[model samples]
Target: MRTAWLAERRSRSPAAHKTMDKIVTLLAKELRIQPRQAQVTLELLDGGNTVPFIARYRKERTGSLDEEQIRQVEARAQYLRNLEKRRAEILQSVAGQGKLTPGLEQQLQQATKMQELEDLYLPYRPKKQTKARLARQKGLEPLAGCIVLQQDTKETPAALGAAFVDPGKDVPDAAAAWQGALWIVAEDIADEASLRALARKTLWDGARLTAELMTDERAGKDFLLYKEY
Candidate 1:
């Protein structure tokens, strides 16, 4: 039976095997159990055994793991499976866009959390018909790049934008070019995942919540206790 299970596991795709190993290792470390314990529990769970049934009847197989431990393993295994699914989808999406480099693919594969994967993929994600798209349509991306590079050029941003002023492209004047460039720059800034993550952390760690009473009489009566405290 063990040999058959091992053969079946070997027949699975390499990625599936990798995900299984990762889940087993992570579960063992997090639950402070032996790897054999986590592995057998996962096998039992995968075989459609109920947590209660396993805890009640499969003590020998599970190394005597309790219901709570088995439940935690089940829940964590589900979450890890879902996370792996999302990771594969993101990798395929980025590859489809022709933007998946080795470094990026490695980062995506190594990301242990959903937020990390999302943050890394933010800049490559498709956007709506946004200001950046409109600006790119007007051929202002180069100007945006120049602004970002901040190279040693005698020409100011407005002066550089003046060269891109083409009425045919709807950029009638330097001002229009500058505006489009600024929009592109703003979109790039918004898409910067690290900056967004830093901002989120700062606000979450330092920001305070305040509650205000409504001016309505019913609101005052409903939140009477909050009015003073």
Candidate 2:
């Protein structure tokens, strides 16, 4: 792990987050230590010095850390910088909403895990209006919350949904009730940790990269315009 951090920091294409991550993974194998442990030593030591310098000058500082380890740490640091830049941009956009509470601010600040950060950002991220948004506008949020709380399984979701309907309030009938309930259902399904995990596994495992067909054939005929697979 330490070796990977070194390679990542010393990477020539420092902006390539994906490549840097891959190098870090590879370097861990050469160093025979987990990536997390390697990362800690890299953090404690100086980074300005080149790989050769660390291999020679700071050997004692790294507990006699070796040449390959230095390379890995450098690469991982570059990866970290790229991630920091992206996180900053995302936080800046969220901050603009004027809705950021202190707990949320702290969560956003210390978000080293990508999945956790995205979960925090999901509600704020740009999106199109769907059935859920429509239901919220229709004043059925209370009923939706009841179904989702899942505290009482026998509370009859459909009956509670029926009680919340008001055509005057813009919900015309049980159809609208179901519509509102459907939105909540879909949102809950999407947000559920287990469901999301299963979906991610299935999606990544089953998904394929397909190229866009060029309607403007002349414009994209060249190989340079071709997208990665």
The C-alpha lDDT values of all candidates are 0.88, 0.66
As a whole number from 0 to 100, the lDDT of residue 86 in candidate 2 is 65
Give each model's clash number: 0, 22
- What's the TM-score of every candidate structure? 0.88, 0.51
In model 2, the worst 10-residue window by lDDT is 39-48
Provide C-alpha RMSD values for all models, in order.
2.9, 10.1
Residue runs of model 1 more than 4 Å from their true location after superposition: 1-11, 225-229
Model 2 agreement with the true structure over 2-71: per-residue lDDT tens digits = 6775675666564454544544554466567666545444554444456676668765666567776666
Best by TM-score: 1
Per-residue accuracy of model 1 over 1-229 as CA lDDT, tens digit each = 5566667877899879888898899999988999899999998877667899999999998999999999999999898888899999999999999999998999998988888888888888887898778989989999988879888998886789899999998999989998898899998887776787898899999998777676875857878667634
TM-score of 1: 0.88
10 residues in a row with least lDDT, candidate 1: 1-10
